[model samples]
Target: MKNLLIGTAVLAMTAGAALAQDVVRLGTEGAYPPYNFLDDNGEVAGFERFLGDELCKRAELTCEWVTNDWDSIIPNLVSGNYDAIIAGMSITPEREEVVAFTQNYTPPSPSSYVGTSDGIDPTTAVIAAQTGTIRAAHVSTMEGATLVEFPSPDETVAAVMGGEADLTLADKDFLIPAVEESGGALVFVGDDIPLGGGIGMAFRQSDPELRDKFDAAVQSMKDDGTLNEMILEHLGANSPTF
Candidate 1:
């Protein structure tokens, strides 16, 4: 549902670059639908799954998928559990301090405020955001808003639906699917807030060589318009492409 993540602050952990191997493991939080998530078949399936597969194909690398919780995804990567993270992770200063990011695969999409018809005043309303995300960081800065943090994007939305929060802030792309599927249960309120940089693949900083390989593949996809095409197919024609 986000590049919005859930976690505590972490210190950067360094490791040696992955040695040449037969298969490169790709890590993702297999819970955020439309980006990466388990399908009805119980296999990883979604936009990032397809994108990651295409990237592996173009880079001529043997790859496999590994699911991880959002809170520990980065740490796992640092511990060498996976070669890279293709989850919907935004490139941010705090995150950058811990891991290296590829050139953005998706440009920064709009962040939306979703709530009932009742207008929410940032000055006093209770707001829910996923922990460790830019949205949570934003809400924390509000002068008077009561901030509630959850471990996943779904939990943040649940907080609003369950009446624990007055409203929630999250990716517009993720919320649109819910709003349309909800049949009027949710509606957009307030102006769209654009937060952080675009979504990118994350890797250990020591793996710049590996990062370079994927970066070239991403650039090729962008150059041939394949990246934007995938974005349209998954996120919709109206969604802005890189």
Candidate 2:
């Protein structure tokens, strides 16, 4: 009887340790480039990939990547589809109410309007924005503009190019490459609009311990200046850093 009780206690302790070290799945939208995206090899790659890996290392946590569509990313997180969101998710009051967020990793970026031609008045033009993004929310508030929603960021750009919409509003970092590749086919149509509090990792409100672990990891990167270097490398020198 004594031996059996000792073996049972040992087993319980081992199980607890295993549960503590369970793999943390980092969720992201694989379509968003320079943030999180699938490479030619179909593996997750880019800035967020690099950042998430480093954070997991610093926190001594086992981690893996999982992709979900942008429209359903938050809902999926809430439903326990993954442990945390490492996609380029901006911190906003509306979002904070649903999921807890780590400190800002990247500084607030300006949202810009891109159109096929210059001098297009964005105030009254038909504007395309990715559905469920802060940019789309902002566009909806524009009194004279018509807001057209698309399921993906690429589709929002296509809406402007295909004449489905006069312009598209999105993160300047994401649009810069598209405009450059367009070879004058696309131009900045209006002033850049700043929105959101910056990008951060998000976890379910129930996972405060997990959130704190990653938050400390993020702060360590910022303190060491590595995060700033990464921001300049992946997002361009013009991007604001920690």
Candidate 3:
């Protein structure tokens, strides 16, 4: 697990990077595989990383990857710890009050649940989700659910694996891969729940210009079919398009 770093120490460094104007800091939680994760070489790798680099390249911007714990991502961005957040962050009205988001690169993904077996009960189950995520917020609203949140998604997975949680909820893209990796250890349970709109790049409220640049790049990718290609490559061809 990564320690939460939300102090001013990182802010100075981030502000300096922003001041440079030539380089755009792309913030992400590297723990979420298939969205953003450390590759075999221990560098940022996965769909969003690939898409982010392409967006920066098309926008004629130099990009730097910055990894941070998910719980404090927004505050750290507001504090100038990074220029923009490119993690698998979903767009929602509540979040709009805090930051501006670029156009979505992927369509809304279904939030699904998984358990050690097929017989889990959502009405009384202790469900694990990553703290500060849309999944956590949505889970909290579930009428009979008991949300057991963790600082990270990996820990949420651990909660289910260790019997600490009866089930866990996450994007189908994430849960499907986890289930496949689990062999017969885990199984999907309950209907797929629709949550937020889609995934977007987040920026400080005052940074509309930066958001616009990314928005344009994302649009270009969609128009040329490159965005769908990337999504299909990582998320399967049946994956939803923007």
Native-structure RMSD, model 3:
4.1
lDDT of 3 by residue, 38-109 (tens): 988889999999999999999888999999998888888877778999999999987776778998889998
User: Which of candidates 2 and 3 is the stronger one according to lDDT?
Assistant: 2
lDDT of 3 at 214: 88
- Distance from true location, Cα of 53 in model 2, Å: 0.4
Model 3 scores a TM of 0.91
Residue 131 miss distance in model 3 (angstroms): 0.2
Q: Could you estimate the TM-score for every candidate?
A: 0.91, 0.91, 0.91
User: Lowest summed-lDDT stretch of 10 residues in model 2?
Assistant: 10-19
Better of 1 and 3 by lDDT: 3
> Given candidate 2, what's the lDDT at residue 73?
88
Clashing pairs in 2: none
The per-model lDDT (C-alpha) reads 0.83, 0.87, 0.85
Pick by lDDT: which candidate is best?
2
What clash pairs does model 1 have? Answer: none
